[model samples]
Target: MLAALALGVKDLVGSTGFSGEMLLGLIAAGYAGTDFIEGFMEKVPLPGAGAGAVAGPGSTGSGVAVLPDQSGNGAAAKVAAQMEANLASQLNAQTSQLQADIASLKSTAAAGSPETSWALLTGPSAASLTPDLVARLFVPATPRANIRTHLPNVLAGLRSCDLIDRDMLLMALATIRAETEGFVPIDEFVSPYNTDQVAFDKYEPGTSTAVKLGNIEPGDGARFKGRGFIQLTGRDNYTRIGSQIGVDLVGNPTLANDSILAGRILAQFLANNEDPIRIALADGNLKVARRLVNGGSHGFDRFKDAYDKGLRLIPEGVEI
Candidate 1:
């Protein structure tokens, strides 16, 4: 045993490079026994020692390297936790900045987009008519109050009938300007051409005028007198137009005086004759266009004046 112990001491001293005093001490420990050698080894500091390692003999518990502890509450563990926290904070900050950047890009895109810019300029419907445009189209003597009161209904009528074309719109507007100078839907005056007793005798029941107008019933001429924006007249016209528009104009001809109904009646009438009117206007034949609507040149001058003014004022290819 003593021989083996001596050999182990020599090997330990040689491997550890212990000099003079340390080598002597190791030899003395080997002589003391295996237990003493083990105790001595436990007290000796090793390079790259792990955490929870016992302090070497004569160690000051400082300036010694240690591995990170697996257990909680150690210095190494605290440092690891602090590093993780810092990394998490930095990641969170970066994530927030990325989100903000994405939001700013979306906002910028929407603001600068062509569609959005056009929408802002043209409004929701891109309608051509405005109070300013209407005022400019009408003569100075035309009543502003009447235009304001009736223009909305007129626009609705034109739009409803799909009369958004520049020429069609001008023709309709001119018709209104000529038909009702005040832009009001009104009952016809007792003129010789309409309901005058002496002049309207030819329009009595069974007469040619009455037969032409389908005025088979007594008092039909007076009952179905000119009304609405276009002055819808005659029982035949009322029946046909009312059926086309799904209104009971034959039973209640007075409904035509309603501004909304009047506007619709006027637009529908124009739509019925749209083909010929468009052709005439295309050919610059205002007289034929006026005749198609009025059956004669009754309001040709006024219609021509209003149409010319509208062409000058309103831009071509304007949409509703």
Candidate 2:
């Protein structure tokens, strides 16, 4: 059936060239109509988004094939999402295999071991993220100061998760830097053990923000108020992120304060948000990026100011 479909598409497209893998993918994706397939092929065709991608390159504006989601759905969109997830699982499995293979290869190579070192495993970002860069990226006398000290470790966590591109790193920093107030506050705003209460100590379990963030019960408000650099708020978030990162964020909500763990969470969050965030970045729409991150235009001016300032600090030799 796939062979026949491929033949038909080929005949219909005439001069258009389609790869066997792509054709098989479209068939598997359950896409119908030659015209739809033709139009999709002409546009950015993302059959499977390639190996569980959280961060992607190219851009929708660039016509380099952005992963279509709610805005660009059909048989192709569904196919792409499924393909991405399946590919991601396959890639992780393949990553372990590749790591072992690289280990074997490194034994023969002059460098010794590539997989053992982050510089070898990570892309250009390994060199880009440094103390000096962090120093430059950080706003003068802001809260995100600790990020400079903790950057090397954060970069390592990013490398482990295979999210080490200039754009992605910058985007991550932009969003996180904005939310964490210069990376100053590792935990949420409200604290149960605080000796002195301030004006904005709003979280109290049944408050509006607290309820929206999934905080219930007596201490649930303070427990999952908002942790992590980007503020992973609410009980739902702690439980979900905990499961994703292999950390007991629910049981030990304080774990979100840990730099490396929090960094991982941040990377995951950025990775998962392809639409609007990555899509906006690809479109050169930084404002949209901020909007998507903030979930609205709230405090956008400050966020944009920080993002622009942060970009100046990225240094040369890297392209986001």
Candidate 3:
């Protein structure tokens, strides 16, 4: 059917009276009609207005003439135009309402009468999440002193994954506190762990033999070799993660230590491992990540339990 139509168009264009430009216009109109014939009538509109207006090629005709049903044809175009205008008006009204709501929320947040925290966390309706709880969370943990040294990189890692959204990002940070009490391999917190060399050595290994036995290399080596966040341990895991993220984890383990790089890798791991996480979350796999990292009695719900505890410690208004 289309072939014959195309041949007819070709003949029409090849004819003497038809100019090149007219032929082009006819072909375009035919093409558009073809689309309309393929159950695309919804896009065709009523007759003459707005998006429905179909001028024959370059012709400036009002389209009422070109329409087969001229008398009622203009009505469809007018209707389509009115419908478009109505939709635009509704959208504008909705947008204004949403903006007003957002402004009101911002004002409420800025009021900072200690109730803001309560509203943000416990919902405006909840009774719990008292002011004291909020204070406990946001009052700062004596600065942890080491928080600045190690947390930024960890945050960078989370940000890289685009998982730095409020809920999960805070969850990850609180999980960090549960994991090592902010004792990153960085300078500030490195002192104590460094003192306990033997214990550290037992856990952090330098060689492939150490990795096989599930031991990590301590200090910068262990940290950069994949410690925090997703805990990208072992050469095998490194290779696998590297392949997955398009990063050379095997060649440059140091990238893991560089918060930004590490955060991205961790984010990739979490997002890509959604199915496993969903299953773990369903099965109450608190220690699902732990199992992935260390493979022990740790089950799912490990992170959830820690998060609950951390939430208790957190103050209102201050996000996790």
Highest TM-score model number: 1
Q: Write the per-residue lDDT of candidate 3 for residues 1-320, one digit (tens) a residue.
A: 33224335444333356443334434444454454454233333344443335454333233322232245667646655665676566556655554444444344334433333334434544433333332223223424555545556655665566664444544454444444443343211333422245423433566444566344434434433435445555556666777876888767765655556655655666666555655664565557744543444322244444455444344344422
Kindly report which residue pairs in candidate 1 clash with one another: none
Model 2 weakest 10-residue run by lDDT: 108-117
Per-candidate Cα lDDT values, in order, are: 0.70, 0.58, 0.47
In order, what is each prediction's RMSD in angstroms?
32.9, 26.4, 22.5
Q: Which stretches of candidate 2 lie above 4 Å from their native place? A: 1-128, 142-145, 182-185, 190-208, 310-320
Worst 10 residues of 3 by lDDT: 60-69
* Residue 9 C-alpha lDDT in model 1: 44
Q: In angstroms, how far off is 180's CA in candidate 3?
A: 3.4
Worst-scoring 10-residue span by lDDT in model 1? 112-121
Candidates 1 and 2, the one with greater TM-score = 1
RMSD of 1: 32.9
